[model samples]
Target: MHSVVIIGAGGVGSVVAHKCCQLPELFDDIVLASRTESKCKRIAEQLDKPVRTAQVDADSASQLVSLLQREQPELVINAALPYHDLNIMDACLKAGVHYLDTANYEPRETACFEYHWQWDYHQRFVDAGLTALLGSGFDPGATNVFTAYIAKHYFDEIQQLDIIDVNGGNHGYPFATNFNPEINIREVSAKCRHWENGEFVTTPPLSMRAHYTCPEDVGTYPIYRMYHEELESLSKHFPSLQRAQFWMSFSDAYLQHLEVLSNVGMTGIEPIDYQGQSIVPIQFLAQLLPDPAALGPHTQGKTCIGCLVRGVKDGKKRLIHIYNICDHQACFREVQSQAISYATGVPAMIGAKLVLEGQWRQPGVWNVEQHDPDPFMADMNRYGLPWKVTELDPEFQLDTEEHQATNAVH
Candidate 1:
């Protein structure tokens, strides 16, 4: 029987545990761990199936190595902070276990996030005979898979790729993040970029916007183009992509509040002297905001995330939009988490399962799309994240006829 250990007991972590429990045969042994033992214990208490809980600071590789040594899990799912990704990867390498995580790593001191830090470990993991799957969560995870799916089945050569992520969920709060407030705010505050003509063009945060009508009656949302980490990896992996961009929805109210906060320097990541002690403003703001996990009961609406591709199939121009819509209430009913966590957690569980089952096992650092998308796509349908693919007519504004025709020539 293969054992699995999940790090972090936050909203996403809780959903990962719940989803793992639903398939007890796949995950014979499960352990939930984080810096706070009580949080893991609290989540484990809600599960009907027994799961062990542990306390380990993800910031310390030694601590994680010690815990992994004792638990002897075959795989480790890291739902913890992005800053701790390297530490956990190190521990996994030391313990000879496969590693998977939802997001790319960013330095704790900087607001920047990228795949370089983790990708640098490719040779190390390859030599150690361990597989490290990066960005297995929804956007970087499923969105990546969606692109590969289209390229394999529909597109002959993808010319333009756009990843639209719209979270229409409302937590009934004036201004609160759907995930970790610190990470959410930092990501929004950074400079956005998109690849075009083999070069990156930069834009101010939330500067470019487009209106998108989501499928499944999810309604219209204003999505802003941003430089998500997936774009970085996808652009490298999919060379046919001439222009690649990522868009996310944000309410006017949310943007207005963010502007005011930035004006007052509340969004600053640098430390400031407060009461004779150094403290980061963003960290202070996080402490003041409501926890994302607590918003599960109050949040309502759906999240629609997918990939829009303009390419060629069978020597003809083709445009396909593949996406999944997840309801916050449905996720809360099933796992006591909002759709954001559900969307990310479900894929994390699926990726860990893929590793444990030997379906995607290999000794190298990789991304989800690097492996076969067939099993992962099937798992999405069997799990909570059902997807849909639709052929677009010429009227689709996501791409131009010239771009489509160019890929058709490939």
Candidate 2:
């Protein structure tokens, strides 16, 4: 039996608590904590088993260390914002606890997403005999595992990688983000970058677009190339790759709204004087947006996320697509949350479970793909997010005319 502390009582945090409680034997004691104690208590009320609830600002390492000292949990699952990742990791080290999170750290002042900050702590975690798993969420989490699984089973050498994320779900709101509005907007509005021959090529945000026809008739949508943190780790971990990129589907309405917001300076992260009080425009806008947790009941449709890999196997070039399709209503029925939160939260629980089971526990800061993907892939099928792997024709190509034209070889 293991005791665990879960921070951030938001949508993903709530699902993590519920999933952890499902296996009482493994997680005997669970404590859900966040800045808003009431949110934690509310989520606790819905669980089949009672979990301890507390309030602590995750930004304060001392407060977290004190809480961990009192609770003495073996692991801390951080479902909080990306900005608080370092503080929570520091607290875990001080409290002598293993750490896991669904996202990498991003400083509050910048929208840049990279794993260098967390990766720098590899020696610290190793010296302390503690484990810190970063990017345990869907794209960075499951998708990373999917790539590793494919490489282990199907590829002799991976030559190209494309991670496509599509959320066909609708929340019935004209303008609302599925997760934290601030994070979502920042990620979408940032400059685009993709790994190329021994370097990264930078482009304007949403400048490179490709039409992706999802399997199972999930609808064809325009996927815009963007720089995601996983691309950095994946390229470094798997050096065979000559090119790598990440793409996400976006609706016209959403893009239009984002453009208007950007034009009006509503999405700016820099603080400006407002009535003698310095305020970040994006933070203020986040306050006015609908809470993502409250959108579950009103959300419908599905999300398809996967990795498409082109590699060589047995001296023959091959392509494989491995993905999972999640329904919002089905997830809500099980966890009272949409598939977005469910997809991320389920993996968070699985990562913690692996650490507790000693399967993935090791003394170092690591990404999900750094471990064996077989166990994680098996758990995904056993859990809610069932995935499928399909081999594509060798002649199949993902590059669109626009993509080819924009990225023309000189």
Candidate 3:
């Protein structure tokens, strides 16, 4: 049994803590911390078993270092804002604790989303004999694992990859993000880029579109192509990948609201003087929007996320779709969170457990696909996020003209 420290107290954090409690033998002691101790305390209160709670400013490396030293945890699971990744990583190095996070580090001041920043720590972690796992969340986490599992067992060479993320959940709100509004808006507004022919090709954000009928009664939803951080790692790890892209579904109402917000500068991350105080427009907007955690009671529907791969196997062209469908109501009933948080948080717990149990420990910064996917996949089944794979003989392809027409201005 190993002690673990979890940072952040959002919907995802809550799920991670509950899932960790499920495996009491593996996680002997658990400490949950965030800047707001009350938030952490609230989550801890809901757990069936006892979990220690503390307040630590994740932005301050020294504070985190002190917490880590006091707790002496075997591993630290970071579920905080993406901006605090480096600070937490630095603190981990100081405390000599293994680190894992669900998302890549993205600075608050920049809209750029890439892995170069965190990947730079490879040498430091390797030299320190510490492990740092990046992108353990659903898409980057589960999607990466799915690709690796396919490459290992089924494919000779993966040539093309498309990751589709469809969240069909409804929170009964006209316009509200499922996660942090600031991060969500920034990611959607940024230009889309994908790897092709050994380099990244860029396009307008929400430019390329396609329609997909999600399996398991998910119905048809229009998905728009967007550049995601996972594409960077997958292309590097899977050298045979000639082209890779990421797509997500957005409703017409949501897009219209986003366009209006963009026009009015409400989505702007830049600081503005409002009533004698400087405030980031996006951050202020986030304050007004319903918190993702609070949406649990009202959120209903399902989420379908998966990887569609086309490659060569046994000298023959092949295609496969490996995906998972999660119910929002089911997740709420279990952890007081929607499926989005449950999906992301469950993998995070499993990833950290794998490390603490010594099943996935390694001395270097790594992505989910860098390790064996079998164990992680098995854990997912035991946990909440079970997955399924279906072979596609004809391959999942969208008509170019139809796809373009969908995205065309009405």
Candidate 4:
């Protein structure tokens, strides 16, 4: 029986545990761990099946290694903070266990997120004969697979790509983040970047915007262009593309709150002296916000995330948009979580299953798209998060005059 240990007991972790437990034939034994044992215990209690729970500091490689050694899990699904990605990877290497994570690593001191730090471990993981799968969450995860699926079946050579993520869900909270507030704020406030003309062009944060109408009545939303970690790997892996960009939908209320927070220095990551102690403003702000896990019951609506690719197929120009729509309420009914966590957690489980099942197992670090998209796409439909693909008009365009004007500057 193969054993798997899941780190982090937050929203995504809870869903990962629930989904893995449902597939006892694959998971065999399930262990859920986090910084707080109580959180893990609470989630385990909600599950119909039993799951072992533990508390370990993900920041400390020694602590994680100790737990992994004791648990003896064949795989470690890291649903923890992005800041602890490398530490958990180190522990996985030491324990000789396969590793999978939902997000790429981001340093705590800086909001910057890139694959360089983790990719540097390619040789080490390969030498250890362990597989490290990165960015198994929704956008980076499913979107990556979506792109690859299109490239394999639809496009002869994908030239332009646009990844659009829209969360039509409403948690009813005035200013709470769907995930970790610190991570959410930092990502949104960072400068936007997009690939163009063989180089990455930077723009002011959320400076570029466009209106997109989602298929299947998911509603239209204003999406702001932003830099996502998957673009780094996708562009590098598939060099045929001329441009790639990521856009996310955000409400005016959320933007207004973020602006106020940024203007007042509440979203700063750097430490500031406060009452004879150093404290990061964003960290403090995170504590004051409602936990993302608690918002599941209140959140309603759906999230649509997909990839829009344009290229040539059989010597003819083609455009395709492939996406998945997840309902927050439906997810809560099954896993007691909202769509944000559901979207991310489902893919994390699928990635780990692929690794353990030997379908995606390889002795090196890899992103989701690096593997065959056939099985993963099949599993997504068999599991939750079913997707659809549609051919777009050849002249379909997402780039607006504003985006063009901004791109012209560089």
Q: lDDT of all predictions, in order shown?
A: 0.89, 0.92, 0.90, 0.91
Q: Which residue pairs show collisions in model 3?
A: none
Question: Which parts of model 2 are misplaced by more than 4 Å?
Answer: 399-410
Instruction: Flag clash pairs in model 2.
Output: none
User: Which lDDT tens digits does candidate 4 get at residues 1-410?
Assistant: 57999999999999999999889888889999999999999999999788999999998888999999999999999999999999999999999999999999999987889999999999999999999999998878999999998999997899999999999999998999999898888888888899998999988778888999999999999898988988999999889999999999999899888877777888888899999999998999999999999998999899999999999998999999999999999999999999999999999999999999899999999999999999999999988989999998989897553532122111
Error of 2 at 334 (Å): 0.5
In terms of lDDT, model 2 sits at 0.92
Clashing pairs in 4: none
Report per-prediction Cα RMSD to one decimal. Answer: 5.2, 2.9, 2.3, 2.6
lDDT per residue (tens digit) for residues 261-309 in model 3? 7878888877899899999988988999999989999998999999999
Runs in model 4 deviating more than 4 A are 399-410
Q: Of the candidates numbered 2 and 4, which has the greater lDDT value?
A: 2
Model 1: worst 10 consecutive residues (lDDT sum): 401-410
If scored against the real structure, what TM-score would every candidate get?
0.96, 0.97, 0.97, 0.97
Error of 1 at 291 (Å): 0.5
Candidate 1 backbone collisions, by pair? 156-312
